[model samples]
Target: MNESELIARYFAPLAGPAGLGLIDDAACLIPPPGCDLVLTADALVAGRHFFAEDPPDAIAAKTLGVNLSDLAAKGAEPLGYLLSLALPPDWTERFLDEFSRGLGEAAAAAGVALLGGDTVATSGPLTLSITALGAVPHGAMIRRSGARAGDLIYVTGTIGDAALGLSLRRREIAGGALPAWAKTLDAAELIDRYLRPRPRLALTPALRACARAAMDVSDGLIGDVRALMRASGVAAQLDLARLPLSAPARAALAADPALLESVVTGGDDYEIVCAVAPERAALFEQLADAAGVAVTRIGAAAAQESVLGPDGAARRFARDRFSHV
Candidate 1:
């Protein structure tokens, strides 16, 4: 299908009322009284952010899901989103069908609707760009710069599932080396975690209620925490053993301790990292628990950024970022 025809057929039905039925060049948004708007955008390219052979539905979910994660980190409720999809010439109808289906499902689940955006044919790889909008109370949006010394740091969900899943996706591990967590080491579940990130939107109420500072862990945990510390003009004291690991991840680490570094420094964990004041840490965890979200205290904000190893010595990571990926 051509650009206009494709958009009208596949995307128009997903537009929100503010989207002007996808007939206008611009979308309208009016924030609620005493509320601040949150905006986040993410771009995904085939063969870079995702495998070219990945299902169109998964690509659509991840493209929008990552953006929602940013909003979640800021303690905002998703409002609406704009999508710009670029399709290669060889794209098929089946691809568009499933991609749009995924987009609609994810948007509805996140309480967001489609706003207006562009669609075009690209000679390059399949690319998706989404600009998501969210809402929060005035002066209530959590920021990376709000952390202070003596605050406790918490990370939502487990870490490194996505990173380990990527390894399985690349066929990096041998068949005989499955983890004890599962007969197949729950390989499909790991891969699904990589493809479909669980944005902690439900945890936002707790974050807004108690978090002093917050940011989503997109890059490696160590690098993202360091970035948050730098933004807050404070330091962090982290315990390596405190890092929460899923059962499969724990089993994998037991089999090969070397994977620990990769777990700490690989990308796409997509969990929220937040700093809560000492007095509020208990309430934060309580709220998170009520929301059915698992949060673990891994460290505290300090005068200097330090990570302690299991041997009770300060250890340094070879790289702060996802350079390994």
Candidate 2:
């Protein structure tokens, strides 16, 4: 099918009232009273972001999910998004079917709709970009520069699973050599995390109410935390032992303890990391708990410009995260 037919058949149904049924050249948005619009964009490229052979649905989900993650960190409610999909010349209709299905499912789950988008044929790899729009109460959007000294640093959900999953998918780690406990590790689960990251939208309200500063962990916890600290002009002391890990990740680490660096430094986690005031930490935790999302306090802001380890000593790594350049 051509671009117009492709969108009319697969994407039109996913548009919201503001989307103009995917027919208009532009979309409309009207923020609620006493609210400000929040905007974020993310792009995914084949082979670089995901395997060229990864499922179309997963690619669709990741393309939008990463953008949603940004809104979540800013404590904003998702409204809609604009997509720019670049399809290779040889892509099949079946691929479009599955890709649009995945995008629709993810958009529905997040309560977001497609506002408008452009579709084009490309000579290189399949490339997808999305600009997501959300809203928060005026002056209430969380920021990466609002953290203060003595504020507690917290992260939602576990870290590093997606990075590990990428290693497995790339055959960097031999599946046959995995330990017994790690052998039973659900490969699908790990791969799913890598492909379809969960944006912490459910925690937005708590973040808006209690977080001093916030940003989603897209490029490894360590690097992203360091960026947050730099943005806030503060230092941090993180207890490596307190870094939350999933059962599969724990088993993988037990078999190869050296993977710790990759766990903390590899990217694509898509979880929220925020700083909360000491007095408000309790209420933040309570609200997060009520939302049924796990939140862990792993560190606190400091006056210096370094990141310290569990040993209370400054630490440095070869590389803190993935760099596009």
Each prediction's RMSD to truth: 2.4, 2.2
Looking at model 1, which ten-residue stretch has the lowest summed lDDT?
Answer: 172-181
Model 2 backbone overlap count: 0
Write down the TM-score of every candidate.
0.94, 0.95
- Candidate 2 segments whose C-alpha is farther than 4 A from its true place: 172-184, 305-315
lDDT of 2 by residue, 132-244 (tens): 99999999899899999999999999998998888777663233453343576776677678888999999998998899999999998998999998899997778777888
**Which residue ranges in model 1 land beyond 4 Å of their true spot?**
172-184, 323-325
